[model samples]
Structures are given as C-alpha cells and as structure tokens.
Target: MLKLFSLSSSLSILFLASAHAESQVQLSHVPSQSQVEDFNEPRGASKGVEARPILVIASELIKYFEGWYPSAYDDPAAYCTIGYGHLIALQACASIDLGEFARPLSKGAGAALLEKDTRTARIAVQRYVKVDLSDEQFSALASFTFNVGKEKFADSTLLELVNDGDFDAAANQFGRWIKAKGKVLPGLKDRRACEAALFRGNLQSGKNSTFDRSDCAGLGVASGAGPVIDIFVGE
Candidate 1:
C-alpha cells in the first residue's frame, strides 16, 4: 500500500507540472489583434493605443531636410535657397490639411535673409498659417520664413484665401507662378508646382515621415519597427 501510494503521488506531481507548463505556453501565444493594434499606435491616445510620435516624425523630417537640402537653409530674407527644409514645411500644410503660403519677392531683398533666427518666423507661421502644427512644422516653417520672410508669404492672396478655407481655389492658385519678371521661368514654375504638391500631403519627397529606426542615433527617442518617438512633451 505504501509503494502504491508513493507512485500515485509522484504521478500527480508530474501531471500538475505538465498542466502548468501547458498553461504558460498558452499564455505566451501571439498577441491578439487589439493588442497588436494598441501596441502599434502613435503615443498619446487612450489605453492600448500609444500616443503618436509626431514630434519625432517632425524631428526626423527636419533632420532629413537639413541633411538632404541645404540650399534653402537660410534665415528669413534669402531667395532661391529651395531645399529639403522648405519642402518639409510645405508638406506639413497638407499633413494637417492646411493651406500653403505662397508669396512673391522683391529684388532688393535678394540674399539678405532672416539671420538664421527662429523666433519671428515661427510666430508669423503660427499667426498666418492658422494650423497648430508640430515642432517639425514650426521649425520647417521657420526655415521657410527665414528664406522668404512672413510678410511675403502672408501678404499673398493664395495663402490668405487658403486660410479662409478655400482649398480647391488655393490649390489652383499654385499654378500662377508660371511667370516671373514679365516672362515665364520654367524653374520658378516647377518650384511652385512642387511646393504645391507637397502642400497636398504627398510624402513621396520624404517630408514629415520618420527616419528608419536604425538611423535614429543618440536621440534618446524610442524607435524600431514600432512607433518613432514614444512620448512628446510638446513645445
């Protein structure tokens, strides 16, 4: 009887151990659809969905512009410096569904740009654009304003009307840049069209998108095949 009882006890222990292992294995199965969705969302939503990493997107966008296009990297007042930075700002308008700021220039202003300062241009962008953009938008706009100045863009009918909520008309107005100094300038026309396209939210030019997780170095910002920045304090 003792031997039989001992064997029964041993068998019970093994059964319990096997059951526990099976339970643990079941618990470790693939995450549910909702769980996966929640994990993938940008930081800042409710439970499950992580908040969006807009700022990181903005940061990477700005960095991309700086690295890829430097000619447009001037202070407010330069001209013909069109670069990736300008492209990012122009694209931000569309991402947020806002209007583009289109302004002509005077010859006297030439390359005497905005001195690489961000304060004035940022204020102008916020005031005139009427969209609450991320820091990347602001930074990109500041760069644009640095190159073109707020007055030039703000005073234009295209931007003014767009701010008034006429998107179709505003889009049509982009084509007006087909001429310069009483003559058609293919380059300026192309530039204007490109800017308008960006304002339409096409990231083909790589504006407003986050960098590769592997590319973001020392930013202390979370990244992976997952969201770019896990948190944003806002600016």
Candidate 2:
C-alpha cells in the first residue's frame, strides 16, 4: 500500500527556484557486517562496581534456552525471575544500540539501523521519518535486529527485497527461516515472521522518501545538504 502524493508538485515553485542551487549527492559509506557484530555483546564493566553483565546474560539465554523462548513476558521463568531477565534485557539493549554504533534505539527499529555506519545512523533515522511505512513495519525492522544480529539483515534477501520495492514477495519470504546453523528451529521461524512484517512495511506502514527535512537547520532542502553545510560551516 504505497501511497503516491506530490509534495514536490505542490512545492514546485519553491523547488524550481531552489533547483538551480541544488546539487545531487550519493551515499557510498556502506556498513560492513563485522562492524555490527563487534558491538553484538557488552564488554568489560568497572573494576569494583559489580554491575550486572548484560552480554553474559543474553549469551547464556541464547545458548541454554531451548526452542521458542517467545519473548521475556511469555516465559514463566521470565515473569517469576525478575532480576536476571532485567539484566538480560539491559545487555540486549546495550548490545543492540552499540550494534548501530550508538545511534537512536527504538523498540522495533533494529534492522534498518544495524546496516548503518555510526556516522550515518542518526541521519538515517531522521530520514526514515520521510519514508512511508506502517508502525508495525517500522517497529518490526527495529526489533528484527534486536533479535537476529544486524549483520543478518544487511546480508539478507530482506534488504534486497526492500530496496527493490517487492513488498509482497518479501512478506512471503519472512516465514522461510527454519534453521539454526543446519537444524531447523521453530524459534527462528517465528522471528522471521516478525522481521518480514517489518520488511514488507507492515509495521509502521507509511510512505517513504517523502520528507526531506534537512539534517541541520537553516539548510535548504537539497541533496548533499550535509556536505554543503560542512563546507560552508566547517563542521
């Protein structure tokens, strides 16, 4: 359900006057898979603080928990056990946030953020506002990364499908995940469903690339705004 509107048409007069001064720009700073994994888990804590170790907790759950964990709320142990789960969530959040190189962390906005380099993550999120997507789609993409590492999303058919604008096929492919390494797992199947919903623009569904609010204030709406501003302002 991609909506077609012409904000540009409405603003054609403004655009024409601005078009001459505007210059096109391309983004080439692709994020690497290894870069995201480096932040996949929490690292050392203060020497004497004795803080909860989030990475250890999440890693343990992933290793020991058998088939279909079904989120923290569904697990009776998760409800009965407060402290350990909280610690795990903290670690998961931290690792996830760091995975995007410390960009904004929304509950279900993980997938899109993961493939971005740190410098571009913030800009991407802001630019995401202009894209048409459903809330579910938006949140699903975010949460997908929250579960599966961002690396998977980057190297996934999901990204290709999204960039290609094949929403329905992408949705169909979401349920295809059934294996962990070589073994088919039910948990991964469910997770893929969630991620697919995100990919198909089901969650947070809306139009994309509609808004071009400058990354900075007082800047004209144009490509290369950042670089242009930097050249003039010397950031």
Candidate 3:
C-alpha cells in the first residue's frame, strides 16, 4: 500500500507540472516598451521607426533655403550671419576658432558650418517629438526649427500639432508664420509654402506642387528664396 501511494503521488506531481506548462502556453505574452510605443503611433506614421541620421538629401534641402553666405553679413533680423544662416555677432565671430570672420567661405566650409548649426535643430526636434518619424519628416521639422529657432519652435502650435500626430494640421500651420515685425513678407510666404509642402510630403525636387504664387507673384520671390535676410535689414 505504501508503494502504491508513492507512485500515485509522483503521477499527480507530473500532471500538475504539465497543466502549468499548458497554461503558460495559452497565456498572451506582454509587449515590450518599444513595441507598445510603435503600436501607439498614428496610422500614417512608420512603425518600429528609429531616428534617422541626417542624410545628404536633407542637407541639400536645408541649404537651398538658408543660402551660403561665406562673408559675414547681417540677416533681416540684424543678426550677424555667416555660412548658411549661422547667426553670430561680428564680435562673436571674431572670437570663434571655426573660421575667419568677414572672410569668403568655401563651399566645403559653408557646408560644415551648416552641419554644425543643424545639429542643434536636430537635437531640439528629437527632444520635442515622442512619436516615430520618417527621414523626410524629421528633416523637414529640423529645417523648420533651424529657421524658426528652437525656442519659438518649442512654443509653436506647429510643434504641438506635430507631437499630437496631426501632421496635416501642422503642415497648414506653417503658412501662418509668414509675417515678420508686423508685416507679411513675400519671401517668407514662399519659404513657408515650401516648408509646408516638405512637411506634407508634397515637395518634389524641393518645389511645392500646389504653391500659390499669387502671394509673391511678380516679386521675383522664387521657390526656396534664401532666408529673406534683406527684408528685415532693409538692405
């Protein structure tokens, strides 16, 4: 009877272990943090997306808007500008080791300066955005931040809309920023349209498909008109 009891006890233990294993197999696995985040993205945004490195294409697009000014010049806002809209005071430029102040910059030098300036924008964008973004989208936002400055971008309705995944609404918000110092500038209007097109994934070869030329018509404000620096400075 003792031997029979021992065998029965062993059999019961094995059955219990088997049942536990089966229950485990039937239970759903918990998702990881990354998985949960990806699942929560807006329908049109990419899934399992990672931050993209700044590519040449993005650099080119930004360069088209900033324009390369090797010599230190005053921007429309009166900021001492050099090497692709890099705002530095003449005094500050003279103190920096990066390049000579008031000297003609080479294309390579201008590109390098642009890369340095854009890094700040990229970092700001990464900090503000929680959802995953495509390379083009990231690039467009970075470019916008580069132009508008991180402080304004941080406080903007555009950034708010973008963070909430309302990209179309955010794209529309770009056009509202065309004014400078209480006046609507034609050059800014053109730039904002291009930026909007880029944000909406509607830009082709750096041109806006449905851009209304009527705003800057006959003003010679071509698409991607550089920086509008002259407007603010009255140069």
Clashes of each: 15, 27, 1
The total of clashing pairs for model 3 equals 1
lDDT of 1: 0.37
Note the Cα lDDT for every prediction shown. Answer: 0.37, 0.33, 0.58
Q: Model 1, range 49-155, lDDT digits (tens) per residue?
A: 22222233333433332333223322222212232223213222224322322333232222112121233444556667774444443443443343334555566
Q: Which runs of model 1 end up more than 4 angstroms from their true locations?
A: 1-120, 131-148, 206-235
Backbone clashes in model 2: 27
TM-score of 2: 0.34
Kindly report the root-mean-square deviation of model 3 from the true structure over all alpha carbons: 25.8
Model 3 misplaced stretches (Cα beyond 4 Å):
1-52, 55-57, 90-99, 206-235
Which lDDT tens digits does candidate 2 get at residues 1-235?
1233466565786787676434211111111222234345354211233221122212222222222222232122122111111212223332333332233334233222222222222222223333444544544444333343354555555445655766665455445433433443444444444355434433231244221112111212223212211101111
- Best to worst by lDDT, what's the order? 3, 1, 2
Candidate 2's displacement at residue 183, Å, is: 1.0
**Index of the highest-lDDT prediction:** 3
TM-scores for candidates 1 onward, in order: 0.34, 0.34, 0.59
Who wins the TM-score comparison? 3
